[model samples]
Target chain A: MTAQAAQADQLASSHGHLVIIGGGEDKERDMAILKRFVELCGGPSAKIVVVTAASAVCARMWETYDRAFRDLGVTRHVHLHLMTRHDANDEDLIRDVLDADGIFMTGGDQKRLLAIIGGTALDAEMHAALKLRGACIGGTSAGASAMSGHMLAQGRAELHPEKGSVSLGAGLGFLHKVVIDQHFSERQRLSRLLSVVAQNPYLQGIGIDEDTALVVERGVGIEVVGEGAVTIVDGRAMSTNVAEIADHATPELIDVRLHLLPAGSRYGLPGADDRDARRIPPPLLEFLENITKRNPIS
Target chain B: MTAQAAQADQLASSHGHLVIIGGGEDKERDMAILKRFVELCGGPSAKIVVVTAASAVCARMWETYDRAFRDLGVTRHVHLHLMTRHDANDEDLIRDVLDADGIFMTGGDQKRLLAIIGGTALDAEMHAALKLRGACIGGTSAGASAMSGHMLAQGRAELHPEKGSVSLGAGLGFLHKVVIDQHFSERQRLSRLLSVVAQNPYLQGIGIDEDTALVVERGVGIEVVGEGAVTIVDGRAMSTNVAEIADHATPELIDVRLHLLPAGSRYGLPGADDRDARRIPPPLLEFLENITKRNPIS
Candidate 1:
């Protein structure tokens, strides 16, 4: 695909706001995201749909949602579960979610969530609602990590960035360019994030600390929210021994230069922005202009 | 690197059994791995270096080691904190780890471990120790994920075996030609693993379940240990999907024929046993051989 098309694709939006909260037991932080979630859902009175994919709070999830919706004054709240093959095509659940204004994925193991919904009818519907219908999508912890194209599962839990510490898994790819790592600082996972970036030089990695959230606006790019800093690892500028290393031998020594961007800063990737800081690059700017003028693919 | 040569390189020293475990907070499981680790260390009395890059349990990692070592009747135990920039290259730590007969990494956040030690002086030394000195290197969860060449960071968390849910990152590459995912069954991450192999059509993907270990016998291949099954996602015999689709708008979908190999089965990519039915074909064997022998710079 051409760089222009890539930018245009990134700019297309069927949703108002996408929020990814880092994992932790921060009710206050969660509430902030929930508030935005409600706003994106078309206000406190808007109907809401919540999906508890990888949550340990299984039976209690619906009750929790009931409380949240009641406290927020939402007109309606529905909880959907896709744990089995049959659940993949639950028409009622899909309809509720698609018709709702906001969809939220609860935290647990993202892998579990993906396994149950991936390639299923519900997954297709969910994508359609978010991509075509402009529905708000939000998640926390594993849910947050699942929103990006690249998701950090587990890394070799070491203090240093090693060749194999950062393990990758599948994510939702809602935000295509960035990979998200949760419980970042509280867990001290900088090395894993860096190692992850080093693995996929094509991706720009973001590590959101606990209590933090990354607010991604379709065309505008990412903004950070919450109590902690969001560490960003841009591998585009990295120089490495990856290409030069001999096969099977430990990779040769190389230093990676990293950029730590907290919430609120907007950055663009290669071809997406002008090299000069003064003006928007012609290529990306044109692409964005196209997105604004033409109808989205959905 | 002829298969023979690669064998020679791995066989050059003991390197013992390279055991990588997925994440879980099970003491019994940890104890079992510890037992294996001690055996790999050559004896309880043998000086064993325990590195807790994965676990924040560094402060008490030694106690765990001591308890295990003492229970095993092995005396000499060295616990080091290799979590910071300086600690990663602590001259004494490196020398101790290199000098020791066994090297173990605790579980916590593999990303942290990778960051500080990756491409550092200590990393090189440790690899040398493993390759030339026959040291046993063990890790769990994030540690297990880091063992492969293609590490799965975060990708799309969909259950579809499509090209998006999983993203590939640079892994330790100790086991080239393989991509790893941890906590497989419990997390229901099969689709992500399948999609990862689909993108990397040539590589073999191994999904290790919690409390499970993949004992890779260098040239001989892998043996699964622990309670759960090691899901092996092999795309070597896979069929392509380009023609099935109408346009490039659809990313490649993998009709991955998955094999869930339980603990105890041996896996050798293609050339391991001269095409035995029992082993998965090591697709990269030929390419790996050619690359090694010719040493192609380009």
Candidate 2:
């Protein structure tokens, strides 16, 4: 199979849009990020649900997002605060979420957010909404962290990557194939992200800077929005000395492909663009080309 | 959180049954294993669909399984031959699978099975059938390997575990939390399974021997059937020197919990049994207990 055909096969199942934002999205400025979310949610007629489960100040967080949506001319909006697992099973809450055209998650503690809603009825409903109903799922900061199936829960920032500095946890899994990190450049989390990709090269590491968003139109393409750049650390062809690093010690990675994509840049869905201007090594390019040919997915 | 509550929480979302069989299940003798699958599919009235995508000799494979189901007094059984990705997207085929009471997958090459059907309309329909329509999914060997979200694609049979010895791939993901290996004792694949768990301790390792099956009634419990024992390698509490191992070198694992459960033995769903006769280390037991307590799921 050609690379194009293989990418098509990988994307055939995706139907929803994932609007993932980095931390500190400009809500007060032009609100471009939130506007993009509202636009994707089908404009003013969209029924949007904001989940502030991750925030310690749930009510305050809800008010902020609610006001933002209202200012954006969204008429139908609701707030869902699941403090405990039992709340995640509330029929009324589940109904509201199922009826939503879009679901937005706020930033705080991803662990707290997932602990309450992970593997619950609401969680299942959210996935169903995305898969079956084509509803847009948007998140920022901790919210973005909880979008992938395998999430980077917490980690320390260092110039050099470490073996066991980063920890992983289960996310809501709206997106697959990549581990997402927020506040990328501001927090200096490149090392931690590199460490994660070194261990699990199958997963690509996507680091979105503050105020930026990665708009993933399922089965179509991924577009970058907002101010900063989205750093993509591809480790599929990289060699790592991770296994040799002692526990909680620094790790050494070799030949990792890094792509610093600025706002307005887009990549083809399912596979990286082969004709991009960036200079990818011949061997690495051949390796990627072989994946589709060898697999013959379509 | 008590064990019962934790079990309840886990079962809250599980709505289907998965009969995962290791390779070499008896088909000619008493047909005990095949009968179990039919029984789970609702017996004589069961509408079974046999997926022969994994086998090279699809016709012969289909005939063998078709005869087994027919002999078991099954009235409605259809064959689904997904030779290519296009077949997996056939609306008629998806409809047939959607109406299935049971879906049986034959063993050959798991990669072939996934390559043809993974991320297709048929795959989505199958997941919907299991999650919403209460259909049973049963697979043998290659079929069983595709049951988990993270599958142990290929590996060598060695006594001492080595780094980078096993290859992992994406499965259909009907089951989570465990990496399954078939033809366990027959192939001596314990070391590879151990190595996988050491690197990703969040996932448990289950090795099923040939002629054996793990009957997973989602949200309830898993029961062992057929002949031989099922090895459950719990890695959550194990301390591994994996970070210090050289590339492709043997790994050193410490305090890994090994449970050799024979047929007729049952454990609670989600969490391993706490009161088993086999002595689990205090730290491991404490860690297991803390999962339910810390998360307070449901």
Candidate 3:
């Protein structure tokens, strides 16, 4: 494995973390999703900071979560409503972040979340807290997408990657080097996400399926949660002629490798498992290999 | 001056090109913008290729341009109407690009434009045309933003060089090396742009004021157009604690400098043109000096 791969392995074992909760209609049925987060966070009683950036969620989404938070006995749950029209530099949001033991970003528009919180004291505070305190940060749906700097807003179709179909918007940047795409499986957004990563080789793309979450512990790597799989696209390892595309004036074939890890599996860079980094299970690896084979650059 | 600066100078002076009109208010206005583009190309009667990606003009934007196409005392006009639905990818769009003489991107959501044309055969065609034919591609608000691969979707109102307020989405990727922001001066968006460039120094950040456009000729250099100034934030000269930010924390000041240039001004990188490269013009030099002086350690 390359040094970056090795470094990724190190991240898997670190402690600073960000987790995602799948947000589909069956979220309530998947109580296991919430339970896993609580367990990883050392229980629901853990002091938590909840930031609601999604407008789609209202009292209903909260009701679904109230039980989870209560069952976990998280009494000091602080919800920071960050969707207000205030500038991203709002002192209130920054202070809330600084004081929080754990930070939770709600799902909605990655653009809105990044627009409101990115580049501000709040964004800085969260990064510092994650790195220094090993504080946990979590999100769902749009929230999951916000975990990474590269996000998929909307696209033409999953058939092929078009110009703006696979968009890279500003995410929370919590997963700074990676791009996060939500509702992966159900949405069949693989093509869109692939297009994004291909354009930006510097980014690693992660796609989270519904009812699934990837609990990423800084220095500790990633732990999968709930049902379905998490698709990881690492373009850094691929070879490309993107710079020469114009000269050729033809659609070039790109070699992209993907990893489809199912729930409970752990994936980190090389050496990630000196502690608990899970190896790519045979089944998942086979599935990913099949995908690349079927989609072999045409 | 650095060697890159000198190279930029030589490139700017050597390339004679056609202008692509991408943004404006309406087709009539877009057409007027196209007319301006024709003037830039050579004269009002110059043969122009209009690539219509504007939803407003896709089906109808061409009809409106009929008069100008005929009345410009000329008849050579290549108009391609490219539009994609939310989940549809039509191959014809790419074909449209391959046959274009000069390309014009219409205004709308830079996101939408990217969605339809992103990684398709069309994107390669446009890029090839530019590099080989020296086609002038100009976009207005959305069009201009799409010129750069790192296009600004939206930003927070934060006016500090912190992190997270400014979010970037994927654009056409035609301008891969730079990150661009539009409607800059009108929205008071300098700090956000600075924060963006600071986060990723490998990419240059440009903020184009409303009505103003920065025309960059690949082998030549860049020239400003329209009403306002183009803020160029070159971070390669920066020395920062990127290690801290990479570790999921915030960036500490090290050494950074920025340059803000008005229309008609230019910057030359090494091996380009060292002398008469706009002379660094006092105002532009002052802008660069201020960034370094403001924070010795960026």
Clashes of each: 74, 1, 66
Cα miss at B267, model 2 (Å)?
53
Looking at candidate 1 chain A, the ten consecutive residues that score lowest on lDDT are A248-257
lDDT tens per residue, model 3, A99-177: 5557766666667776666666777777777666556677888777776656666554333333344566765555556
Kindly state the fnat score of candidate 1. 0.00
**Arrange candidates by DockQ, highest first: which order?**
1, 3, 2
**Per-model lDDT:** 0.60, 0.74, 0.56
Candidates 1 and 2 compared by TM-score, better number: 2
The DockQ figures for the candidates are 0.02, 0.01, 0.01
Please provide, for model 2 over A1-298, each residue's C-alpha lDDT reduced to its tens digit, 9 standing for 90 to 100: 7644543343344356789999898877699999988877767667899999999999999989888888888889998878899999888766889778799999999999999899999888887777776678899999999998798998887544657888889998776667999998667676678778877888878888899998876545566798876766677756555686577654434345555555666554234443452333332343223211211101
Top model number, DockQ? 1
lDDT of 2 by residue, B1-298 (tens): 7644543443344356788898899988887788988877766667899998988999999999888888888878999987899999999766779778789999999989999998999888788777777678999999999988888888776434667888888998887777889987666666678778878887778888888898876554556787765666667765555787676665445445555444554444344443442333332343223211211111
Docking class of 3: incorrect
DockQ of 2: 0.01
Quality of candidate 1's docking, in CAPRI categories?
incorrect
Q: In model 3, how large is the Cα lDDT of residue B194?
A: 61
Question: Residue B170 CA error for candidate 1 (Å)?
Answer: 40
What digit string (tens of lDDT, one per residue) describes model 1 on residues A66-182? 676677677677878667757867786577876666778878888887777766777666666666766667788888888765677666534334566567777666656668788
